[model samples]
Target: MTAGGARRGNTRFVVAGLFVAFVLAGFVSGYASSHPDGLEKVAEEKGFLGQADDHAFANWPLADYAVSGIGNERLAGGVAGVIGVSIAFVVGGLLVFGAVRLRSRGPGRASAPTGDRGPDDPGPGGPGGVGTDAAGAGAAPAA
Candidate 1:
């Protein structure tokens, strides 16, 4: 791992992935299919579109993919999209980072070793996949 805590050479990949995702979400998504998405289309085809229940928070700001009170529809949609993307990225990153940190610390560590690949770690076969025994002693290779 690097001094910043991210695994060595992984920070670049993560940053690039995030950049690509944000670009796709913020800009490219505007050109996506305008036809009702799966659920809405299904509802319409099923003749239940009129019976669709109203969203409880439909009046909330940034609801229905548009920012409330924004005069320009296009700008409002873009702003709301960007905001949603940013929030999702931040929340997802925090959750993932927290989970990884928590998992890396292990269960009730009592002066555990600093390096990764602990003895309890599973092998390439994964948990109980023939090769990965509880003791981490891999099964013998097939002839």
Candidate 2:
């Protein structure tokens, strides 16, 4: 693989690792905020708290970070936390996958192969060789 490909692969791995770490951290140590955050505080102050719509899944099989009707709260919370983490990881992975695919095309593409020319060597086709004319630039030349 080319250096650029290797770098992109490494970046993907690093991002995947970070996603796993974030999920594990949230699961092992609970993630509930002790105080209401900025949005919640603003809602309370604005007296529009009643404007909130009840989520159909508010009392879902897993709600409020605890599996509903579970005998053990801690176990239920941990299971729910892990489920949340997995969902986040899957979503992040899908986004990254889409970005990579999208970036693999077009003129400003990052993963394009770079010709190996010495500092003194004239690039591809020499001085007048294979200039990046519109047609030449857009064509995907054979590997």
Cα displacement (angstroms), candidate 1, residue 66, comes to 1.2
Clashing pairs in 2: 125-129
Top candidate when judged by lDDT against the true structure: 1
Writing each residue's lDDT as its tens digit, candidate 1 over 7-88 gives 6557777778778877776677767778898998999999999997889998899788888898987677777887887898
In Å, residue 138's CA in model 1 sits off its true spot by 31
Model 2: weakest 10-residue lDDT segment is 121-130
TM-score on alpha carbons, each prediction? 0.61, 0.52
Worst 10 contiguous positions by lDDT, candidate 1 = 134-143
Please give the distance, in angstroms, between residue 72's alpha carbon in candidate 2 and its true position after superposition. Answer: 2.4
lDDT of 2 at 23: 61
lDDT of 1: 0.67
TM-score of 1: 0.61
What's the CA error at residue 20 for candidate 1, in Å? 1.9
lDDT of 2 by residue, 10-115 (tens): 8788668766765664465455555878987899999887798988889789777787776876677877777777787678778777655533434554543886
